[model samples]
Target chain A: MNKPSVFDDFYSVIPAGGIGSRLWPLSRADAPKFLHDLTGSGKTLLRDTWDRLVPLSGVDRIMVVTGRAHRAAVEEQLPDLLDPNVVLESEPKDSSAAIGLAAAILLRREPNVIVGSFAADHVIKDMRGFRRAVAEGVAAARAGYIATIGITPTDPAIGFGYIQCGDPLSIAGAPNAVTVRSFVEKPDLETAERYLAGGDHLWNGGMFIAKADVLLEQLGKAEPALLAGLTELAEAWDTPRRGAVVDRVWPGLTKVAIDYTVAEPAAAAGKLVVIPGDFDWDDVGDFASIAKLHSGGRKSDLAILGENARVLADASTGVVISQSGRLISLIGVTDIVVVDTPDALLVTTTANAQRVKSVVDALKLSGRDDVL
Target chain B: MNKPSVFDDFYSVIPAGGIGSRLWPLSRADAPKFLHDLTGSGKTLLRDTWDRLVPLSGVDRIMVVTGRAHRAAVEEQLPDLLDPNVVLESEPKDSSAAIGLAAAILLRREPNVIVGSFAADHVIKDMRGFRRAVAEGVAAARAGYIATIGITPTDPAIGFGYIQCGDPLSIAGAPNAVTVRSFVEKPDLETAERYLAGGDHLWNGGMFIAKADVLLEQLGKAEPALLAGLTELAEAWDTPRRGAVVDRVWPGLTKVAIDYTVAEPAAAAGKLVVIPGDFDWDDVGDFASIAKLHSGGRKSDLAILGENARVLADASTGVVISQSGRLISLIGVTDIVVVDTPDALLVTTTANAQRVKSVVDALKLSGRDDVL
Candidate 1:
């Protein structure tokens, strides 16, 4: 059911503290994946996400939560985001800590403020469906139940974690929301296939909409140390010594995702319910995701020839990316990913793009960022 | 016998009238292989050949015989050779026509002169041995015999024609002079291997040294029409309208290789003599010849990678030349050639190098000189 957008003070909690090392050269310490225009279409993922978020939330209400190091990059791309609302984590904390910090900041300002905890670097295909799910979650959060939006599983994707559905929720007026049975980490290929076959599982994409107080309460009960540090960091945010204060506390926290610290435990207690959204959401964790977003339905008709061609594949030939966009005329290349960066190149079968991160990890260990 | 340096009037005859479609872009109509520093080295083939010829022939006596189209390129490279002796044919009329033309020119003024026919684009390794052979041929030519400097056979190379050696001629007063032998066209792979194993076979390198009058007599009997045309062309060459004179008679002469009309026929008639020259000689007709010249003995060791590559190859995966001299690195490339030139590129295996000329022919048929 479509619902009209209604929020007193809509807040955006853009978590950009994590280093997207998986994206490498395009997502370096200087300019993360969210800041770079990977599509070559000029609009960066972060900027596009902001453009989508700003229309729903007024310009003054928008906040970009990031690390102190990324302030300049975030500021450069998003001039529309309020400088005071652009909250920096006292240190490089996990996503759960960042969410807690955003929750503490917005709850102190407005008791029922809908804090949208969105990723800065995802490519969402259906904005309307996404907004509808977000609106439903925001509405649900105000009613004291924590809400998360999950994407309908289309493939047996082993890279993504799965959220199993329980019985339909008893919440009034929101029939589409379901009680979450459990949160599963990235499944094995066999489990992923079964999930695809079972049809009750949705990919646990990192998207959430909740009232600041509900999330803070969940954070306090699920991860108390994270909640306390987040409260102190949120209060100290924007102060001259806030970065130093957050940095000291950040290293002490366990590096855990929100699902492990809150959603899984909250589901066990029967408090976490997810709204199944067919918004075509993707975390864009690897070349495979990028290929899906780019291929649309034309995956079979694409032929990319170059040095560093990050292409997705099926049973046929794959893609090639060459350096400097040089003329990559392939006569005999097939079913293989050909990556040509300036310093190095990679050629492997499409079934192995998941292992491409192994190359990235090797590059990091080998200290070949000049190539990475 | 390494004889005295005196009593030898060394006059070099550079044969530049052969069509080099095999070399393609690097050996185009305007700036053939002789004019290029293909190895990225400072000196060109013509420059290197001339450097070697200058000390033996004295820069004053070094003459180049090329087609009119390539005359300017040759003269431009060796401006000092632009004297009356630098012969330029209006059209490529093969080595038979070229040698006859040189013979007629040298006959009038330089009596007992030793004319050494040298290709401007062949790659030879051992310059000292080559000079020794030429000096020996010059001494032999003074004693009256049609002399061919034969390369010591290294392998069963089907790419080159072979010469059968006979008993050495007793020079009487001279040593290291050989008499009448036989010449054979490029045999099949099996025949070449057998020839290599049988011994007494030499690579019939196009290099020849002989007295002007002796060459005149041989051409008169071997190819009468070519010999007469050369005599007429040389006579008219002293006149003001030499270009028109040569072009008028050029179409009348038979277009045949020097091996067929002179070397083979002369050998079959029991008049062909050869002197063994111990030099690493290669015609450099295709990539196999080029591979031998590269220090690593293969272009595979000299790879440059690029993300985007446009190459002009002499063979299928043979010699890759990129148009942009920019860095081009190949990651998982093997047994392939990549080349880049400003106008064109080729990508093919070295196995298909001989068929590289087919690319030019295809372009010509398609009316694409822009790429050809």
Candidate 2:
């Protein structure tokens, strides 16, 4: 008999739908973060995510769950994406509905298949390390445990949640797997510093892996109504009635993230495991994150990203994303963030990057939806 | 006999040629600062200068000396400006060549005309006080002295040159006129503070008034070659050979400022008078001046200037000049200056406003003159 591949029957599901308001004027309502090449890799984040998972799940086993508005863009970015493997949400019903529906559909196609949910707008530098962690997480999933790839904390980052690990799990092919003690929300600076020093807490990057049936079972245990609704939609997803069913059911689905619906409850029940991922990862959360990702920790460096971006910087250190094809000139500005798009521009300091969302909120309040 | 207006025989000469590089992106080589409406008023600075001088020098007596490249724009801005009164230089030959040529031309047109050289880009908030100061300076000019309106020092501003005054002049309708001991260069901060404290110094605002013959005489004494070249151009100005003479003599003319060619030498000769201008005046030299001009001394106020500029600023104190019709959003930034044009954008602190010229220089060095 031929030896089986480690990624046998593994499926990758990408949930790509977030405006990423902190990255405003670049990531708009029609074009979200996943549609952008934030890493200067000459590929959209969604395309990068698809490429990252192709080695493990193969091209045919990958599925994308995104807003109906972004269907054409996602397809354009990932032309190899199959018609049947794409799930379009009529509207945003949160991560629970998006992930659970994908899981239910995958289970219907093959009950024993393993499904891994990965965000479409994240950046992972070390592909070898990322693949190794995913393989270990898949091994844990095959052992009847919902697995999460917890990133090793490199700094005291208060922007992300923490995953606390307990005793180690000795699953076959997954020696680094450990029982997840709990899933904690984003902590304060002191708590984050303690978490970084403790060595038992890893950043919760929201990469979840599990058997299709196992994820559905965990969803059922946590929110039965949400699971039932997702199951109903999944049954009709492969049929011509997919449109009618989604339009009728998506708006009424529960709005909750997978961390609350599955990871938190599964951890409480001792059915979740965390595989340590020592790879570099980032959600591209804000300009500050982009600055850090591109600067390579050089505080005095200016990070500029765009295909036709013409930047002239002198004695300045900052992040400048120019999508407008205009020349961006910076002088003696330190730690500033300048995002120039076609219709809007954003200027702020890296320390106030998170407050960019308030600008979007104010725009929305003023009914300036054309730019948004 | 009919009573004469105070402005009778008084003509205004606007030397409008500097690129104002420190206000870059908004102020380009083709479209310099004088063409921009930096005050958020409905008129450009050149037009404002015309309006301000109309009450002192009637529309028929106001003359504009600018580069030939900007002749069309200057005419469009001031349609009431007579064609014969506008002197178009084939190339920039500095303030002395521009103002001296205009003086030589006015002397040829009418011998006794008292010509006042007012910068086309300075901001004067108090029109009454400005006219009062100009009338006093003109009175001193009628008394055969080269007269300049020295602005009252409001702060220890090192950005402006100081005009040291000595003894009072007894010219009628000009009680505030004093003998200019010397015209000093821009001083260091300590020297500027001492000049401010000594009460014997005033800011040399470059508002010089003199008879056309007197100005030409001073220019002949200081720079005879420049005066001779300007006199030749002026002799041919109203003839059909105007363009030929300008083309032949403009580039060969001396490149010097009026301060060096006339004011300083006249001060040394004990034939210069300084009229103390208590009006609020600003040269609009840089973004810091723009911030101070628009913010009205309110440190925390965000000053936005553009007709179609849609701005959303929160907890930000700075100046934003948006000419691109884009939505500019600022968050948690202090003392920042953002200039958004259609082809280029600039971001810097008000403290580094003067350094913006370095960015323009860099662009020029890189052969990006298309944007410049």
Candidate 3:
């Protein structure tokens, strides 16, 4: 096989949504997790994700599919992204609709382009390793496979969906591509441990690379109604009727994850392939992941993010503080997460980091939309 | 036995100082614990202390010895306290000097007057019980004893000094007054338990009642140099030379608690007695006390202070949040204390609540005076 010119017809789709409730108070509706600099890096997670893909898919070829509310922010963060490439959704219909809309739009424009969908909030540590995996996944996509980048499991994590690998694919320029045996939901600790020990399981991080036409075709076969609505919206997307069409059809589309609508269903049909992602990847789903990221694999006693947070950690370990120009003092607190914002503050332990969503839910129930 | 006219020749001295470092981030150098409404009550601790004593000691008869920095705040909090009675100290020279100056000033005005010294930061639950104890203590003072109120031990608490009571005094109208055997420092857990079991130890709450001359004479005996400076400042307190005398003598006085300077030595000389205080009393020294106060003996899973603090506690017990106009969310955090301010935030556990002082010290060390 010769060197593949994969970038020639490749487009990147960044689906940005979710308030990241597990990282509440800091990650609010107006300023979701994607807009935050969770890693203490200078750039926001969305901007970082855009930067990572710029080398593989030039800025113009990368489309951001986000809620209309976040379109201004996305544009402000990525000034180089052309206005036409930003696919604005009227309402959140989950990953399937967000990614499907972007896929449909790209298909209408290029007809034979490969669209790689990556979350705007997830973190990829090694850019070189991510680029290599994306290249392989894109190669497999060109060979009529609904390709997904599967992260090599670093821990027996129960918080993520796991992907099982089957027989290796013989696709050109994709030597590491293997057919996805199955896509499993978030498992219990025992099952996660078994998956880790089995050596064939990988973390499915919602990264999907497939031919735009193939993804639409899979959606058409899986859910004909969702495919038809997306097709109608895509046809009117470039015209003035786009607004009226979306208002009528967007809310009626099925709200489901791409994994449920495409990846898992396509895997059953023997069309999905898993390309191994050797690099470190994190969805930064909660404060625990943010703490782990800040610790830099060293298991730090305290992890502080943002320039204004001056933390004094005393007899405390595994504590994280994401703040807004405040001095956060942690005394004799172990494995606690503190997110301090201008209007709200969140304090919880690492064990209950996932339950932060309950706080957001409770706030919503209590009608505290000002802080929510 | 004739009931003596106690009100005619009685004055109250309130020594107001101490930043309450253990409650740091909320209590600071400029605005100490006495100035804050730590109990979530409408009035501040100083105002509460003043209100509790106003029935026994008339507003004009209560002398507040406070630093020049807090004189304005003290006056603002206590509007009824006469201008001449608000003795402004050039600098803090501990309770010994602060109380001694008040005693000397009252003694100059009314030679045979009795004086009761109470800290301006402590909390007492029952006003009637406190008044009863103070009256009994005043009767003992008339009988020529340096009388102090000893809180009836509610628990084997090792945080307070214990007053060992010998036998009940034989003075009329002083039924609960007992001879002070000794003043022991905060004891170890075993010693505290033994003290509690023996029924002889009561928490010494730094409340003293004595004839103005007797307290001055005792201070003159224990710390002659301190007494001399206090006398010089007191003599000029109502005169034009008050500022000059205080500026010259205040900083040179010995910095010691009245417990060491007069109470301990006076007790050794068979001149001290303890009037058992039946009221619930607390120094409100740390976050644990604040939590306890919030809990109100109900054993609440979470205790919140301050208005506009909406806390969502899940699987968390005994968490405290003193906040600004912000929503504070606590999840799966047990026995944790979260204090949210405009410029500073503190996250710690109830077990480590007392170590909040260490955070303040660390802040000072790190030159974070902005938050301290």
Candidate 4:
């Protein structure tokens, strides 16, 4: 009853960046959201991502693209990852540069390798459904389409982008694959409800799968200078000039998201396909979402995170992230969010969770770099 | 012409106790509310009380009755206090014992010294009004009346007991003194509103002025064994047997508040009068009161307390007591109460501030003595 591995030539490029300011005091600039075990699953989000990809791409074929500041932490979290596959950027040039460089480097070794770009801080519970979607995406990628795994819409969420699915594709081993008509921005509530009820749209979770050579070709077609710089850096990646080349070229590269530079342009040109993923997934965007994730199947509405967190909640419902070794007590406040760290503390409600970014912005404006 | 110091024989006794559980994390069992500067006035409440009393009663005539645990802190906060003026209880025996012991000891020193007992944790802004009220109260006390200062109610507050002023007294130099009709417990909203409109009800702020012998005689009439035990301990207070006498008798004294054991009974016997105090006063019963105190003239509604606290609040209103030297950030929350200490943190709201005692109770039930 052993299932055969179907992604031998697939490489998972994990783009680990973004400070997740909405989950502040837990996710900081130096220690981004990827490093913390936010889901109370006994593993960090990045580590969970590695474990998920290992079953499909194996450890050696997975490449981690992160800032140079997080290189030591990513290596420490993923010790089994190959040192040669760790791609460090001098500074963030957005997803286009991070993912494009990974595709260019992998294409230099294997021209037709299927590269899957997954964010390092997402949460996926169903491994079976994830593996199935990735299998279908890899199949579509082999047929010359830039494939993406679109999450089936479960709610009228105004926080995420939407992908409109067109006619079904006839690629082999990819029965669920469909041509992507377009990628839309996050909509208003009324528009999101219409998209949810219409059943023609899926949430774009920023997961893309494509053949390495095809991805580089698309990037060259869209932004020639970005692709040329990435190709030159990829050529010197294996040599001792990686540090010097990355430092010189990363800051100069055009900053853009993969959705804008690659997915949207390819979809408009009729060169994109999407495989629907019907699994439970979350970006852990705010404390409210984290509260919902940890309160699953539990009678209590209180969600307490951190290994040594000492929390005593009474008649209260919310999320408490206790990174400091202090006792957190909540009483008679519903939908509250309390994040306790050694150097800073955040108190707001679930309704105000998304507004936590304004607090971080105020701190930066006040020149409180110590806490930031 | 220079204004002379009034009431040369007046003695001030400050009863400094109570953990103030409703202000948890900021107020703890080890460091009670009197030890903290809950208002941003650059002085602890106990120190403010000491400074307020020094003009009427010289530093040598001011006595502080606190628990054995807070002896060092109380002494350090009031350095000019005489060594023999401190009355340390092994455990809390309530306000009756604390104030009665100070009265009995003063009675042994001077038979008819006018003793004024004021709680150490109250806030009074108008020192001139307070001095006028105390002078009138001292005059009534000299005329053989157990006088209490009753604050003129500015609002229908249900957090404090109400004192009903009866007929006006015609004593010389005590025009504001009136006979107390009765002392009532904290009332419901409707009753509080009724009292506020009645024009005769005042907040009983637990301030009492009486001759030392008169207070002891009233205590002896109300509870004879309690007065006898206090008298025995007071006889040995200045001797080496002071420790032995206190250890033998203090624990056995009847536990009762000064209002219940003396004020109410003295009013019933027609021996009590009240002096109308037209000054801003607050017991600081909860975070809501503290917020109002600190945000008096500020345009912003947010009230931040603590010397080294670094806070960045945006679109938030309420109180933040940050004693842990941590950066506290709040966003888009209204009426919130955040108490950040070294070992514990409490997150609630001004609407739920009174219920914070339940949090402390839950912590006690969970055996979190380290935080308690």
Candidate 5:
């Protein structure tokens, strides 16, 4: 099940989008979550994700699907990416159209090829475990199933969706893979605790692998109009008509997530399988989660992000500082997050970090784009 | 007894020293608290204090004692100040020398003139009440007793000294004036509560009035060396030898407060009186006090100290923002103070606002003068 041969036919398709409004003042629309290095590492999340998948899929085998606004940034960040391999959607039509368009484009190039879609903003610390999980998923995909890599629940986190394992799949290299019974939405604390205690549920990390034709077949079964539009754009993708085709077709595509349009429906039809991932994973969703990641799994302490930050904390704990080269002093303040930028500052307690999205909404309502 | 006649002979001396370290980032060493409008008013604290006293003391009768570095700013802020009235100290030598030099300089011209010393940064909200109190203090001064304006206790605050009042003085035009029994240092909460419970105690506002010759005579009795240095400087004050005499003698003068060198000793000699001030007053010593002032005497709420600041708050109370024309977002944080400047920002709770001075001290220790 852990054989390296499973990675031979795998291709990586990264769906890079999402402004991550919950991490606002640090994550803006122009420079989003994927473009930022939230883990204090020198590399951005997109680049880190690219580096992680490069071993399995070489530079030419990896494709990135992003909005037209971010196409330049993606190309600038990943220099080796070929122009044809960079799928630029004219506008955002949700994850379903983005991934379906990438699949359709890849199917036009090579039929029956296995394409794995991973988000660009997620952080994967355990590379070996991630590769093993992806290999298992790819093997399951080859066995004619839409396979998803689900993270083993380390904590009863209510912020993520869950996948329930029904029965074990009998794929050759994916002996640990199981048939997904149901895909549940983000649960409450009680349901999350029950899922953790049951041990049959895993956090859906939103990673999926399937044959390009199989994914298009699922999209065609679910949303025929979206599938037809993606197919038409794919037909003109490498031709001189790509710009006109994308501009005409992208706006009419149904704006829905793949999880709702395909995964849930496919799971009802016994077409979805789950491969359990044992690696550390985070989407870097909010400042509180970021504080936890920066603390290196510590209970309560300071989490600093930049190099020029000089912090003096006294009688304070759980202070997350995304510094802007300024000296910050925290005294007697606990469980607070301070994101200091050149133009804007966000100060809040960990309890209210999730409400930061509404702040962005308010800013948009007021037309404050200078900070937005 | 609160006649307008006592104000005609009264001269005002404003000792503008202390850098106000507790309100750092807004009140810097270069631009101290007196120069800032902490109340969101258009005028600075010094200008407000000057305007409040203009009815009692004409612009020509007011004298300002400030550090040599602040001389230019003080002159620019108060253009009506005559050249000889601007007493510029080469270095800070505390309140005793600053006030004593002012008294000696005034004594050289008019020996029997009553002089009042008020800090440049203190806020007086009720001008009529303040003027009445100053007039009563001037009457007590004419009656041959050094008089101090003591505020009616609004709260049991431990940050200020308490004045003990004895029998009421039977002097003309000063019916509310009482002989001062003693001046106690800043008390603990229990002692402050006890003092508040007793109606005989008043909060010392650090405002004093006495005849120019009487203050000089008291200084001569307490610290002869300081008095001698001040007298020699005063004799050379209007002459060409002023610079030479000041350079030789100013540094050797004892650095002490007027309360210790003159008021306490004068009270022990039964030559001091206290005139109760029935007005709203605050020293604006720390951020918590500033927050209270900015709240306009309300219980607990958000207080903003700048016009250009744009704030977004959610489920928060007791927040104070001194903005630097930047947008600040606060979520689910209570009792916090945020002072945002162009170069530095300070975020702390109301309870720990007094600890800001230590933060400035730490900044100085780390050689962060750019932020300090």
Candidate 6:
């Protein structure tokens, strides 16, 4: 099978560090979101993502970069990748700081090797399509380009920030690639609907592929001090106390998202390329978003038992995920969402789902880990 | 303290032998409604009634007349009442026949003693008031008259039939005595409201106190054959072959309520005397009525909790009776009745509480005795 491949010596650094609080109750600080079996089936999101990456590289070729807090979990999740090679951040830092560190560390060992970064907590249903995108990303990275797979808009999904692709990259027999125009922040309903209808904006899947050399050179050009510090730190990675050395050098690092640190600036530099991807993808942000991914809005519109029991059953109103232990009988509940964990239950309207974070915030302010 | 002593020389015979499909999922052939601990206070209605009657009578004076199927449970409930004298029924006979039998049998031992016949599944609050009423009933019976303590009307409670007192008996020094004008059938809300306003009508509390001689004489005047056969059987009650003899004689008895068979006729004949009872009482005919007895009313309610987790908040508009071992939370329910037993739960608006019998009818047709 003449499958397309990434740059010959590429490193896929999957970041699994973020202590995602938006998916609270189900996801906890001690056991983060990536570890949850959201599907109700046994496999976790990180496990699925790791399996997707395995065919492209060997044990040493793939490196996972996570927080020091998550190193043991990462080792346990991907046993084959557990070694001195895997990078654990000294202190919890922004994604770009970790990304820059991974790039600098990998470049020293395989100077020509490409770098691919992925968020660990994502669901990509179309693995074959994703594999093809990875192969395309590796090719682009070899050509000294920063490559990001932008998913074709399926809905006016406002949960994700979008990327606007400018023109198609024409290469016969190759998957259609595009030159990216500009990044778009997460939009309101009207803007998201316009992006969906306009057919240019794509969901930014947070999976980027670029060569280690290109990433370093760009960092040097864009943030020379940050690049210098990461390089110095990577040089002593295998020396005495690698993490301790990085911890000593970490205080001066800038705190910013990778999108803000590099992707936004690099896209403005005219070298950023976007490839059209047909993969069924999700970042799985919160309970509301995770619910959508679980059913995919494709089939299974949940209908609680009705009629015989007095209830306000208007389909347009809201979805209720209430405290119906083994069996939940919903009566007279209208336009509300109810989610029951073994402990606390969450009840609000779907219109207020995004603001459910405020509930968590209030709960945290009240010092209620028992609820959140 | 000279507390006016209320004597239960009167045997409290709860006639639960009839096939009560009206109380399905609770009153089954094997385990009737009287067997269930509906109070959720670790006491069955029969047991609660028995306890209530304890202050009034000796253990021998408390008999539960149930079917052959419920003998074991009845015995189990009152291990003390299992001394053969506490349970009496003619293998699931109708109330008329059971009452006929009750009168004849009790007369053999306590020939001139008053027997107060009551149902087991009724709920009574204001125990002090109930005790005073029972005392009034005992006093009225002592004066050579058949006495039935009638509850003063609080509303036009259409669920119960009513009695209109003609006038005071013109007796000197009688504080709460009345002559029976006639018994009224259950009426509509307008009629019931009027009855409450008139201050002369009483809800037939289904509690009757009369000398065994008076009850037998009334039975003789009405169903002479039933009364005569039962009298003949009464002489042979302590005989070894009593069950076989009862089987032979009981089939000849007609299926009629005691009110229709004797009480109404005697009242029509101007021989019935009424004594107004001051007691917080309920027949607990359905789950809805049963709930009100717990919560008091919608305005003033009570809660049932477990291990600090409140299981139910009972109200007049709605009541929740929970089975132990599960957490229950009810929201926004009004005028609804909820009975949660181990096997199944019943949820119905109390307005349709009379139609709750329809649910029982359906269960009976489906042959779901496990639920019952």
Best by lDDT: 2
DockQ of 5: 0.70
Candidate order (TM-score): 2, 5, 4, 3, 1, 6
lDDT of 2 by residue, A341-364 (tens): 998999998989888888888889
Kindly list the per-residue Cα lDDT of model 6 for residues A1-372, writing each as its tens digit: 122343357677887877666665446666677886655446777887787776776556677877777778778888888586587776677877788888888888777878889888888877789878877877777676788888988889878889998877653323566788988888999999999999998999887788877776766677777777888888998688676767777778776678876777778887678877888888877655655654547333332321222222222223333223322223333343444444543434444456656556666786766554
Task: List TM-score (chain A only) for every prediction.
Answer: 0.87, 0.97, 0.96, 0.96, 0.96, 0.87
Candidate 5: tens digits of C-alpha lDDT, residues A1-372: 232566767789999989899988988888889998888778999999999988888888899988778988998899988777888776778899989988888888888789999999999989999989998888889989999989999888877899999898689889899888898988988999999999999999999999988888997898998889989989999899988887788888899999987798889889999999999998778888888888887867788776577676666766555456666677788888888887788889877877899999999998998887
In candidate 1, stretches whose alpha carbon ends up further than 4 angstroms from where it belongs are A1-302, A305-372, B1-10, B16-31, B38-41, B67-82, B89-100, B111-114, B132-204, B210-228, B243-260, B267-277, B284-292, B298-300, B303-372
Worst 10 residues of 4 chain A by lDDT: A1-10
Query: What's the distance in Å from true for residue A260, model 4?
Result: 1.3
Q: Could you tell me which residue pairs clash in candidate 3?
A: B301-B318
Give the per-residue lDDT digits (tens) of candidate 3, residues B227-316. Answer: 888888888988999878877888788898888888999989989999999899999888888887778766555787776666667777
lDDT of 5 by residue, B62-143 (tens): 9999999998888888877889799999999999999999999988888778999999999888887998898888888998
Residue A210, candidate 6: C-alpha displacement in angstroms: 4.0
lDDT (tens digit, per residue) of candidate 4 on B167-258: 99798879989999999888888999999999999998889999988888998888999999999999999889998998899889999888
lDDT preference between candidates 2 and 4, better one: 2
Give per-residue CA lDDT, model 6, range B1-372, as digits (tens). 122244735566666554344443345566666776655667887888877876676666766677666778777887767465644564555777776677777888787677887787777757887777766666666675667778987756777888888777743323576778888887988999999998889998878777888878887888888787888778788778787877787777667788876778878887677878877777767655665656656534533422333242212245555543443434333565444434444445555556656655555576754454
lDDT of each: 0.68, 0.90, 0.86, 0.88, 0.86, 0.67
Q: How large a fraction of the reference contact set does each model reproduce?
A: 0.05, 0.95, 0.97, 0.89, 0.74, 0.00
Worst 10 residues of 4 chain B by lDDT: B1-10
DockQ, per model, reads: 0.09, 0.84, 0.79, 0.73, 0.70, 0.06
**Alpha-carbon DockQ of candidate 1:** 0.09
lDDT over C-alpha atoms for residue B204 of model 4: 89
Docking class of 4: medium
Clashing pairs in 2: none
Give each candidate's interface RMSD in Å. 7.1, 0.6, 0.9, 1.2, 1.1, 7.0
Locate the minimum summed-lDDT window of 10 residues in model 5 chain B: B1-10
Among residues 3 or more apart in sequence or in different chains, the pairs in candidate 6 whose N, CA or C atoms overlap within 3 Å are A6-A138, A321-A338, B25-B372, B27-B33, B156-B192, B298-B316, B317-B335
Clash totals for all candidate models: 48, 0, 1, 0, 0, 7
